[model samples]
Target chain A: MSGPKPNELIEKIDYNPPQKGWMDVPVKIRKGMYCYASNPKSVEYVHLPHARPWNPLEEDWKLPDNWKEIVHNAFRERLDRFRSFKVFMDICVRCGACADKCHFFIGTGDPKNMPVLRAELLRSVYRNDFTTAGKILGKVAGARELTLDVLKEWWYYFFQCTECRRCSVFCPYGIDTAEITIMAREIFNLLGLNIDWIATPVANCYRTGNHLGIQPHAFKEMIEFFVDDIEEKTGVKVEPSFNKKGADILFVTPSGDVFADPGTYTAMGYLMLFHYLKEQGLNVTWSTYASEGGNFGFFTSHEMMKRLNSKMYAEAKRLGVKWILGGECGHMWRVINQYMDTMNGPADFLEEPISPITGTKFTNAKSTKMVHLSEFTADLIYHNKLKLDKSRNDNLIVTYHDSCNPARGMGLFDEPRYVINSVCNHFHDMPRNTIREQTFCCGSGSGLNAGEDTELRLCGGLPRANAVKHVHEKFGVNMLATICAIDRAALPPLMDYWVPGVGVTGLTEMVANALIMPGEAERTTNLRGEPLPGMEE
Target chain B: MRLDELLTQKKTAIIDKWFDVVADTYPADTAGFIKRQKDPFANPVGGTTQKSLTVLMDELLGEMNHDKIDSFLDPIIRIRAVQDFTPSRAISFVFSLKKIIRNQLNKSDFNDHRILAELFEFDLKIDLIGLTAFDIYMKCREKIYQIKANEEKNRTFSAFERAGLIKELPGSGPELA
Candidate 1:
């Protein structure tokens, strides 16, 4: 190809003639430089400070002078929705407690992942604009003003924070620095400035109605893949109800669970459970049209959150499911628990999810008859139902890892543990602080699991890894279990980086492993619904 | 006695104790001084920025060479300017009320009440109270009033106990306020 296009550093020279005695150099280099595409040079640069000289007398430095107001207005119009300069300054306390909470901090000891330091990049600008001290004194009391340069820096670091509230749990004032980070990103997004990774998912959610960018057909294919997996693993052919007419349950899971690690196995468990329920003549008609329950829009803005969640509710209504089931995902539960009620509606068809078999009722239901998969499964098991083969999961000595969203955000602390304990005999609790409301983020929960925030994910996931490692060392926790699909997709990489041998699996993986084969079935098969190759007893 | 009743009694004792300490520092009529201390924004500091006297004083005096002016006269003018600052006087009035409340209520007894007091320090010390400031003052005032309401409830409950009006401690009579 064009021999790796020429590396030329193009420097803009500001020509300002001195009045007779000033320095004889006519050319003062400006701040920005664009290298010519044809020129071959080793040094490549953009917005290099030394590349250009600034002259106050030059019209280029003046606003509405260099770029037309139309272009400036366009950019400003986008930034209008960004967090107010005042609001940003008001939120951050810079306590440095968030420093240790970052996976990046724990992984590489990079001080930058410390949420406090990360936020200072934006907080400084707020101080400069709105605070008197910042106007006079710079960087002393931790304040700076937002310039165009600072805005760009905000985009860089704000995106670095994964909006995981792991740090916020410990904050004495409950100051969520992630809020500031999201605001910063939203501001950058408003200015039509977007990183490819965050923007792509946002765009996908906007278009296909899911973050995976998987169309309805592809999403259905994924559900069927899980069906095939369940059939192969157990011996039941489950047609995952898709946009089915008047289905009783619309089973929604984070798409990551269906496609990626620990979650795929969890998807298998879900299918197997439904198959068993169907065999018992339970009216559990589940569909996958509203397959993706993850609100990736949470990573962007409240408006985006509303749009995504509204789609989920509309689909649930369309499918006519009495209850909507959310799979293991962090921020999805946060949206489901905290914001969905106010944002979406008083969804009438969905009651406080009554047990279809036991006739037991859930008391604390709001927004919708929203039931977590773990709760649904565990409760069934609790009530002497969901015939489980406990011995089949003897291969694992499992310890449950409470994903923060379900634990802290939704108070779903018991259901997953109950399910694991019922199926697996080797269930052990992590340290008190490390489970339930105080559970650590898998370091990479939220969209930080992607390529862009790898460094940040590594740093932020450290505390979670440390907790897991402690459990592994003490209890020989060979298998770490969690209910969230995001944890399944995210924690494996974190485990690889921090604690190598100890692996993470979905609680349902443990369940699917232990499901008893039917004796009188037409085809007593594995998950694929075929005759067993090796017949025992 | 119920734990809450005991806890309330303990709170009254603690408030009395704190008042004793403050009484040693100044007079009980220090209500005037406390009132003076209650200005919410007496500090004239806003935002997360660091404060500098030179820029602020320069703005007040309308003189750039405020530094060249006699330093002694500046402090006097600034102090007087702050004293005359309408907000600071209002802050003092509110602060006197807070000190009164603090003197009466036990800090350890009510964690929420103590937290409210500490938060109200911004109002009491600086005199920056505005409409929002007034709302806070009224809220604290209501809390102070509730102490009496709670005392009356307790007295009635205690009398009921003595009179055998009710047997159990979470008494079945009209629940305490």
Candidate 2:
């Protein structure tokens, strides 16, 4: 009573918040949460609309005149073209089943990050412009006009989503919120508002046939460097041919594998695996034209995704390979599995992918005519083709992280695990809910894995990292095995931050570590130059 | 009973209140979800907060082991460090415990001179925990910046190496080189 009342003391704490509807609150675009704006050159390179420089942090976004009409027409056209789009916009009941499912929502504790509310951000605009109830009732119908503030809110939350489809899994209506995010991103690109992480990669992929813009020679030189690295580790040289005509199979992987560490080790894994198959007369060629397997264009727009993905079949046809074998990548397989045949295919020129060593036909990829590396390797293991020494990986207690696209887009749970189990001695699943279809994203998927937005990536990664921390503490899981190149690139820093002492690896890297190639010297080290289990001095 | 014995007797209620205060730092909707969800993996932010507060309460009553306190504080502070919290607000939960203890002991039995002296000593201990939390919070913030800096450097270094601009990646800093 003398110093201060209890109520005043409680008031000193910053717990009370303003009582306002979410729509009434203005968006506060935080730094370190969003990526920089796309460069004009990159946007222009891809011939996307409204290719002017703009920054998200600035007040003026430099939108074109008639920007509202542009958005209206685009929204109407998409609703008409994609029936699923219209259906999704109409069907959601806001039951909140998917509210807590989003990793971003769970990690950031931002209300708008909830799948129901994030969709409602766009749905509110849709209700205003597209629905009769919205037109009549306005605020009562939960409808609001699409102002510049609304557009900024759209850009912030849509990009925040990794399109991991975890929310869609929990939705009672089975509405794919990733598609909603995709539609929002496509509309954003109409105004040239693409993030630098996405626009630069799309531009590079369109021009140089890879996200890094590495020319053909440089691409080959990078692979040759990995060959040198593989030779140094295993004392066996792998001769991976590029652009060679009449090869039996053409191999394509993400360029991140060539340019980044950890992924570089995975690239070496592919080299050793292919080199081992070379002795058995398995002729596979690497194509510089389709060098990238992960499509940043998929994150940009549908037409751009098709334009970049067309190169895969085109290069495979030109090389005259019987079929194509994709490398360890996530969205790349999602594209091939779900959209490739319909988008660029009738790949009638390519044959149904059959494992040259196992003599097993890949009926799953018969239509798309492209086989996933995990599926092909799993087939090889089932056929008892490659001799493996599991003890080489004894240093690692491995847990598989199912990449979002491969887990949800395609039901590819068993193949990667089968491959991991066949090669590595110690394997543990993170948890029942966090693995397979319910697997959490590495949080950097969909071209959001830029350095500037590391905090966002780390925050979004906490749920996945938290699950990994549990297994890490319980089972001493040291290596996070994934079939995703982005995971190789992203999860290393994630593990470094949240759970130190754990390493990120690709399934192929594990396979190569355990692979006992014919005429190879006694292996002293794994692909990362870490000494093998018992050989570590 | 003694101050430690009384605190130990009231441990569950103290921790429950402490957890509520910490959870209230999140938004109302989020705080509700955090309190509602019991599973750690499904609601890590809530689970971590509850778990950290329980351990911190036990340590506050008992040995006040700095290492055990830091370890529990790590997850909660690490979370708040990335969330949109100011540094003081991020570690304010530790201080909030002082108010909770005072309110819980506000009855006449606890108002004796001896108990009031003991309460002063206990408040000092909470202040020590607050200092430790500040250190943990700063370390987590530093780690975020470090991760960001390292990622940027590695990206550029790899690109440079690929272009043959540099023969070798540099060490952690110029001083290391």
Runs of candidate 2 with Cα error greater than 4 angstroms are: A1-10, B168-177
lDDT of 1 by residue, B40-124 (tens): 1111111000122223223222343334333312221222121112333322322332333444545664467545555354333
Q: Score the docking of each candidate (DockQ).
A: 0.01, 0.70
Q: For model 1, how many clashes? A: 55
Among all candidates shown, the one with the greatest DockQ:
2
Q: For model 2, what is the alpha-carbon lDDT of residue A444? A: 91
User: In candidate 2, what are the lDDT values of residues B10-85, reduced to their tens digit?
Assistant: 8999899888888788777888898899989999998898888888888887898999998998899999888878
lDDT of 1 by residue, A1-537 (tens): 544432231122211112231111122212211101111110011111112222322434322232223333433443454444335456655665555555443333234446676666656655665568877886675664445455444544565565666677777767676766766655543444444444455556666756556667666665676775555544567655567767776777777776554566677777777776775545554444455678766765677778778877888777777877777677788888888887887777676677787676765555566877787788788888766766656546788788877777878888888889888778778767656776666755546555434434544565566667667878878788887777776676667655668878887767766666464243234332324334333
Q: For residue A68, what is the lDDT in candidate 2? A: 95
- For model 1 the interface RMSD, in Å, equals 28.8
